[model samples]
Target: MNALLIGAVLISFSSVMVVLAGLPPEVTGFYRLTGGGMAMLLVLARAGKLKLFTPNTIKWGCVAAVFFAGDFVFWHRSIAFVGPGLSTMLGNFQVIPLAVVSALFFKERMPARMYAAILLALGGLYLMVGVSWSGFSADYRLGVSYGLVTACFYALYMLSLKYALSKDRVDALVLASAAALVSGLILGGLALAEGQSFVIPTLKSLAAISALAFICHAVGWFLVTRGIQTVRGALVGLLLLLQPTLSFLWDILFFGKPVNPVELSGVGLALIGIYIGSYTKRKKRTQ
Candidate 1:
């Protein structure tokens, strides 16, 4: 499979896998990262490339992990206040922050067409979530606030990971392992402080959590990190629309959610935007 396709499939599974794990958010996050980290460590050791703890690697890896852990915590909490669909849609606002950061810090030039593509993708995402603007409760407002915070941390994580990958000394395996290790440690500590049990409640839950760790966290994110090395940060954000879009389809198919025509149309628009964004070429600077 192509890198984009791999990334799309992996990310699409992430939310669903979290739900299937059926644990408290912090505990789920901890296991997912720990399991993934251990798996990556085994892979690195087998390949005789485990010597990946250089100063630059440690610095950027920990930075990315911290942001990722924050993103996970806020987003999972938002899901309790708001429904997952709306929370996910709001969390995806990371694209805006990512675009701004890229322009200011990375100095990566964006084309006009790219901006149009981003707008189209976001519009489609808004529609896909079927957002209701009419009602606002305190809880819902709090959830929205949390979701927005999740977006900021998520954007930072992506940017940090991109920067880490750009260094010659860092590879995808090491970065993924380091991120998972640090995130797991931080989240595990939070889970304990919250008095959440670390033990899996059932064999079924254990299986699900293991799948999340190995498949979604280890394999899925590994491919995504590798893919982002070739793809731009802004474009990667646009491409991740596939995750929520697919998650919507899963809900409709398995969870007995009523299908809406408007939302279906939103899926079409999101796909079109992804295509446009993927193909849009940056104009070359004339020296």
Candidate 2:
């Protein structure tokens, strides 16, 4: 639980890191993945686990990577427009789609409470984005859209990575390394297409991005994955709420963003809805 809490906090810093790095989204994504991949590779090689990369692992990792890259692109873009706190909160909507996918494909049963929870979450989201009959600004709407798209991509990444890890044949480090490498290559191409420079302009920017990669992606996610193994899925979902809550705090503390009371209320409601939606009923034992 402690590790999971630490991982959640570390993951929350990613959006702040991107904002602080002050680089184009594509470039930021590329550098982050490349650095994290290299670090993971080194760690895996040192542990003699490089030989555990099977073909299935590579294929699934690449698939996960593509989704991850898409998530990063949209998330960073949304951050620029909507601010980190709202964007992070919006991105966490992946849980809704994840639930839908599971129910559709895996025959997972969702109780009535889950449906109510979903509605509450959607309402909360509407409030968070300041959407109403009066209408929202175009930029705010676009940012909201991007953040939702990010959730979709992140859902796909999580599902694919979960499947890959379930195989148990490949080391977690190898899979992470492969995913990062593939994400880096894809984002590099995107950067070129967008006419963004690949070069790091300043040492500060480089250090910021490097820390994002090493600390957020490599170490944070590693801790998360490890902690997930020992925690219940429902509990994990609840713990993940910390990421966005802390992200909101960082946005205010570090970026001097103003607090919106309505939005903060929405965040609280959405988090409650997520907790309710993620609730898993345990079966009763018969004596």
Candidate 3:
């Protein structure tokens, strides 16, 4: 539980890092992937686990990489336009699409709670943006759009990665590094085409990027994954909620994101909805 708490806290800093880096979204994503990838690769090398890169691993890793690249692009753009709190919250909308996919393809039946959860979340979103929809800046609207795009891409990435992990005999760490490096290369190509410089301007930005790589990606996720393995299923959902919840708070505290009573209520409502949707009920066995 301590690991999970610390991990969530570190993950919450992800948007803070992106904001502080002050780089283009692609550039920020490039650094995050390459830096974190190389670090994880080194660990795998030290552990003599580099041989785990089966052909199956590479194939699925590439597939997952493509979706993740899309996720990074739109999510970073959303962060730039809307600030971290709302953008991160919007990304959590992945649950809706994921639930739909589960029902349609996997033939899994969603509980009544999921329908109510979706309504609650959408209602909260309406409060956040729909109320002042006409008055919002073009960039704000685009940010929200990018955020929803991020959710779709994020959901696809999660599904592909989950399938790979479940079916392949690859080490989780190896697959992660491969996906990161591949995605980083894709973003690198895009960055070059856009004529963006790889040169990070300030030392402060470098530090932020470094933290994004090592702390948020490498260490924080590692801890969260470890915690998930040992923790109860119900607790895992609640514990993981800490990441986006703190992210919203961090934006308010650090970036001075303006919020009113209604928006605040919306945040609370949306978070509750997300939590409810995220929780999977475990069935009991008959004796």
- Segments of candidate 3 deviating more than 4 angstroms: 282-287
TM-score of each: 0.81, 0.90, 0.95
The clash count for each model shown is 0, 0, 0
Better of 2 and 3 by TM-score: 3
On residues 1-287, what C-alpha lDDT tens digit does candidate 1 reach at each position?
A: 25765767776666666666678999988998899999888888988877776777877878989999999999888867765554665576676677778888989887786688688867876675536434557787788789889988988997898787876548777886888799999999999999998888888889888988898777776677677667765577566667766765665565555647776776677566555554534445488
What are the clashing pairs of model 1?
Answer: none
Instruction: For model 1, state the Cα shift of residue 160 in Å.
Output: 0.7
Ranking by lDDT: 3, 2, 1
lDDT tens per residue, model 2, 165-246 = 7765566778878999999999999999989997878888888898899998888887887887677777887887889899
- TM-score winner between candidates 1 and 3: 3
Give a tens-digit lDDT track for model 3, residues 23-61.
Answer: 998989999999888888888889998888888888888
**Residue 81 CA error for candidate 1 (Å)?**
4.2
lDDT at 145, model 3: 97
Score candidate 2 by TM-score against the native: 0.90
Q: Which candidate achieves the best TM-score against the true structure?
A: 3
